[model samples]
Target: MHLKRFTDFALRVLIYLALHPGRTISINEIARAFDMSRNHLLKVINELVASEMIITYRGKTGGIRLARDPAAINVGALVRRLEGQAPLINCAEPLCPILPACTLKQVLNEAQHAFFEQLERYTLADLIGTKQEKLVNLLTNHVAGGNA
Candidate 1:
């Protein structure tokens, strides 16, 4: 199943913050580093802040930072929260005559559950464990360029 752009952006944001740790990173800076839309990132950031995954600060020197440690952020839980309850397939559609007898839906459901269970075993900390320096340099260099 393909995840939405919102979920993708959320994960990217979390990973970026995980790499930086204590530094307050700005939305513009993140957008620039990822070459993503600022408006889209803003919406993602709003949801993250509301969910208490990240904290925001305002004013001249203001920016955003992780609400908790990377190790404390469950990747699966974050995906579930952002993805909502949308099913992988529209099994209830009237167009499909074999909806009742088809095992595809059930099989897909099991697969999806397994997918999340696998993700549950990992945290944001696990994502940036060894790539911290590379990610940090990539992000900081973009910020240091002052092009955002």
Candidate 2:
């Protein structure tokens, strides 16, 4: 199943924050790092903040940081939260003729459960394992070079 752009951005924000611990980072910095739209990034950041996945501060010295440890943020839970609890497929959305006996939706449901189950086995830290320095350097250089 395809993930929404918002979910993808949220994950990227979490990964970026995980890479640079102990310091607050700005939306502009993250936007530049990923060559993303600041406006879109702000929307993602706002949702993440509302969910308490990340914390924010106001004023000139303000920025954002993770609300908890990377290991505490389960990938599956984050995805499910971001993706919502809606069924993966809507068998009766258009009034399908087999709506009364549709198994396709149930099959899709099982597959979605399996997908999340696999994701639950990992955490944000798992996404940034053994190469934080490399990721940091890549992001820093990408920003420094003003590629976007």
Candidate 3:
């Protein structure tokens, strides 16, 4: 299943913060780094803050950073939070003739469950482990007016 753009951006934001660690990054900087709109990124940032995935600071010198260690942020949990409670399919309003007897929904549900189960096996730390140095270099270069 394809994740929405919002979820994709949310994940990107988390990874970006994970790469930076202690550094407080600005919304504008992130926007520029990812070539995304600041307005769109703000919405994602707000959600991330509310979900306690990241912390925000105010004032001129303020910015954003991860709220906890990367190892503590479960990818499955983050995906679930970002995706919310939306069902994979709207079987209640099914237009198909065999909707009532369909096993598609059940199969899809199982697949989705397995997908998340796999995600749960790894944390954000696991995501950036081998790529840490490369990610750091990319982020550093991106912030310094270079391509990521």
Residue 12, candidate 1: alpha-carbon lDDT: 97
RMSD of candidates 1 onward, in order = 1.9, 1.3, 1.9
Candidate 3 has an lDDT of 0.87
Specify the poorest-scoring 10-residue window by lDDT in model 3: 139-148
Clashing pairs in 2: none
Candidate 1 lDDT over 49-94, as tens digits, reads 9999999999988999999999999999998888776768886675
State the lDDT of candidate 2 residue by residue for 1-148, as single tens digits. Answer: 8999999999999999999898899888888889889999999999999988999988998999999999999999999999987897777677889888878888998999999999999999999999899999988888788675
| Model 1 misplacement above 4 A | 140-148
lDDT of 2 at 29: 83
Give the TM-score (vs. native) of candidate 3: 0.90
The alpha-carbon root-mean-square deviation between model 1 and the true structure, to one decimal in Å, is 1.9
lDDT of 3 by residue, 1-148 (tens): 7887998998899998998889998888789788888899999999989989999999998999999999999999988878775668987774878887899988988888888888889898998989989987777777686543
Model 3 clashes, total count: 0
Worst 10 residues of 1 by lDDT: 85-94
